[model samples]
Target: MGWLAAGEGYEIALVDGKVAARSTSGRSAGKQLKTLPKALRDHPEVERLRRFADWLDRHAASCVAQVDAWMVSALPVPSAVLGEVWADEAWQAALRDLVVVGAVGEGPDATGFLRDVSEDGELRVVNLDGETVRMSAETVTFPHPVLLPDLAELRDFAVELGVAQKVEQIYRPTWDKPSDPNQRSSATSEFAGGRYPSRFALAARAESLGYRVSGGYAVHRIRSGGRMVEARVWIGEPHREDDSVTGGLSWSSGGRHLPLDKVDAVSWSEGMRMAAALYAGRTGER
Candidate 1:
């Protein structure tokens, strides 16, 4: 952004998302000041720039969050919608380089790393064949890492191309349920008995990691195979102040517990991922 005259002799502009000042008639005529001049601290231009910077920060975070939600649910988004938001810097930053799959006809799905969206709503992507392809499909999906059949190969190719995604997809950690019935259960105690200083601390950890705390349990809800399943870990009473210990992780749908064997691949991986993250923050183990 260009600098605007803030006071009699100073100009102000947003630099690195913060208001910065420069003298227009002194020894530092065109050089940015080490710090904002006191006289320009309350200038209208400076205040406006600060507010704009704040809005940009919020907008960027909101974009990332929305993209993350769509990826997690493997939701199919219209190609036109992508074109509509592509012009916005925040939206572009969030959506750029994400692995997208176009639902073309029955031949084979078009999969590639998203590169651009045209004004006419066509998507341009870099395919696995090291070629840029344009897709005009009605809808496209950001499939979950677990659902991508060529996830490992994609990761390798992404590295080769030096691709970096604002929202994690291909590189996100995942787990698979054991095929043996003997290893499957209604709940798993693998991450249980992790000790925290207090119930508040444990709950706070869950919330900080974007999980919900409900009825004394830390819960992660996932949509899998057209149904919603909740994976929860006991975090002790909400009103309790004493030390708390993490408990077993379990999955349920429609208020009925589901065995690990019945849990879908995405749900199982995400559940274990959440449990392990919470347990990693514990002060000790029981």
Candidate 2:
């Protein structure tokens, strides 16, 4: 994802040649706040997100434990609308039934865990229990709006838990179903600015947690079949944005695009390294 961004004209990739590193550098620090001290579990917003999470688990059962569907394109709605939205009797009723069925799970505190913190640092009240849930600035990290789920983590987890086949087949169907009416309305009507058209975003959290990487190349396409995904890329020297612009002007030369293919399921850096390896093969042979 990061490589794609670099290829398409995003100039801010880091100097380390690590795409994941560059992305984490650009995230809003607020996302780290998702972890609230246990003492604050009773906070309203925490309960709300918990409830929301439970609701998600219950209704989106197909996607609950799988990271394959990581890209959940959503609008950043103003904090004011959360209550009204959650207050929809039908939604609440569904939530209540979810709680009854143990699908929502037990809340550590009176407040649920699903929460949203306003930009002003105020807790918004959700209709789940009519309580104000607090937002933790520490746990919230605002990443690039286009990031997708880090499937590598899920793949590892599935292997560890021995659910690889079941999870892979169930959670990520061959095709995505149509958006629900409720889901469509939320995306179209109630989000910040407007709908986010970009469906995939790069995950920096996955990188910080020790996913290997190879990046800073250009990707032409991604091909997936029979449980394998391959990234097609091109190799070229890594140059700072300024170097490319000025050098191009001086020599009256445009950029050159190489033909390279990087393997998938490797860290972002490793992926780029694969591209470099291919490039080396051609040049060294010559």
For TM-score, the strongest prediction is 1
What is the model-wide C-alpha lDDT for candidate 2?
Answer: 0.27
Off by over 4 Å in 1: 104-109
Poorest lDDT segment (10 consecutive residues) of candidate 1? 101-110
- lDDT score for candidate 1 against the true structure: 0.89
Give the per-residue lDDT of model 1 (tens digit) for 85-119: 99998999999999999885623438999999997
lDDT of each: 0.89, 0.27
For model 1, name the residue pairs that clash. none
After superposition on all C-alphas, the RMSD of every candidate to the true structure, in Å, is 1.9, 24.1
Off by over 4 Å in 2: 1-73, 92-133, 136-146, 150-286
